[model samples]
Target: MIPSFRLFPDSASTVSGEVNGFFICMLILCSLMAIGIAALIIYSCLRYHRAHERAIGDQRRYNVPLEVTWTVVPFVLFVGMFVWGARMYFDIERPPDNAISMYVVGKQWMWKIQHPEGQREINTLHIPIGQPVKLTMTSEDVIHSFFVPAFRTKQDVLPGRYTTTWFEASKAGKYHLFCAEYCGTKHSGMIGWIYAMPRKDYQTWLTQGAAEGSMASMGEKYFHQFGCANCHHFNNQGRCPDLRNLYMRPVQISTGETIIADDNYLRESIYDPNAKIVYGFHANIMPNFTGVIQPEQVAEIIAYIKALGPQPGAQEPSNPGTAPSTYGAQKGLAGPGATSISGSEVQER
Candidate 1:
């Protein structure tokens, strides 16, 4: 179907109307102020021309109340606008507890998306109407922005960092998607569509893609492949912190600071392991996977870590006794200068 157009893109997202309303209010306030100031200037210039002898007559020394009115009124109006914007900003940045998460990778000229259910899409995002969706995005090369004018949401996807944005489709339809940042040669061509379908239809679309493995499953394989499981295991023998049930949990670091073990934290731990050492673990033990782990693989590892934790209303895993899936394969991958991770091999300083 041909998408409808208006002075503004269809307010198809939960925040769309709110953002548009805020923008309209700002426009009206600014325009009125501009016109008022212009009119006042014109009237004062014409009425108080030097040629008018009576214009000099009635020159009041000072008007304290009028000055106060201008100062207080604009201050109050701006403060109100600031508060409204701050609230919306927090709402947009902090995804809901029950939000459905997805991944997006921005490359030179295309968007690569991955659904938790193992579905994949190129340059298009499929979301269910009336449900909150959180997108964890990154750039493979340079910077790119994930923007949907209809949703009134835009977030920059940066290289070597993860940025997130969330939105709920209030209306079902196809909306424009653009990489708001200038990436490369084909930056303008880096465009797509966001399809908001009904719950059932969305589910169907999800199943239409590859159904082989979830992000967590692929992460699990990489966890074994990269030998991360050997050190960050469930047992006490491993010096590193146990990743099980670690998501959304506050972890104390050696610097005496407590930080949430979120996606960025995990990424940092992999990229620069010594940046924030875990409270109890010795510094400089974990090896950096900066150049070794690809962006997609890092996402998978995060997915696996997220899966290790309890979801909403779910119970924690009662048993985590299984050995690292690659305990034996370590000898092969961990060649000459490798850290020991097996039960009797790993020990704290």
Candidate 2:
């Protein structure tokens, strides 16, 4: 088996098996019902055949017990099927709490993925096996879909809103990831891969990235390049809300609704900022950056924030360092004992 192909239990296959089970039950019922019907037809034909021609008004009879038996039995069987199927539906829709998150962005011609560690890929995804992987996806330009044929999971990716799908690979293998929806002229080429590596390998990969320099740093670099830090910060420094610990916190909206800053909520707030503006921020101040920011950048930012931790003052810079703290400088600040930023180029343009 290919390393990325899931040969074991996965969201797609698990849900598929449940559906197939229902279908198999239906097939069996249909077969039995067919046999009984044939038997009744044959019996009626033979039993009613008289030696001589019968009168025009031959007596006809209906058996209430037979009618009730057939009707009630089928109804009970159907109810049972409904309950079973509904249970599976609910289970598949809600992912486990500890599921690993990967942000997916679908454009007309490509699928971009970002791991929480900030590893970015186009048309490919790397995930650890035997773990629940939840994909929070959105479209850049038009409608698209994220599909993994091996796992049997598909969810539409719409513009101006976010959609999610989750799956767990039972075994590790390379799987085909396709944009199931007709997105554009290049839709057919909108394909990628999913690498279900061992948990150790996944951790190793993450460590490798961090050793090289965390994706958070890369995300911070991109944040400025992508113009996200401009509007999203407070007091014209950034237009939207402060990014310091936005996730999973209770955010009070200008509309007077308090919301948990979860993945879906954050996704919506980014793609459709006017939907729920923060209590102090104005709606529409956030220009729709739908197609501008790449999926990889989004992942890096989220990863960077996640890595920043959840302490009370974690969001803010540690301390004031020095004047002329140029952009893109890795040194934290010019404070005492802080690393110096000497030869770093500050690009204001």
Over 110-219, each residue of candidate 1 has an lDDT whose tens digit, in order, gives 99988887777898989999999999999989999999999989999999878999999999999999999999899999999999999999988877776669888888
Candidate 1 is scored at a TM of 0.81
TM-score of each: 0.81, 0.67
Q: How many pairs of residues collide in each model?
A: 0, 14
Give lDDT: candidate 2, residue 317: 43
Best by lDDT: 1
Cand. 2 Cα-lDDT: 0.66
**lDDT of each residue in 177-275, candidate 2, tens digit only:** 988898878888999888888999988877765333445677677777867776655322454666654444455677665555555666666556688
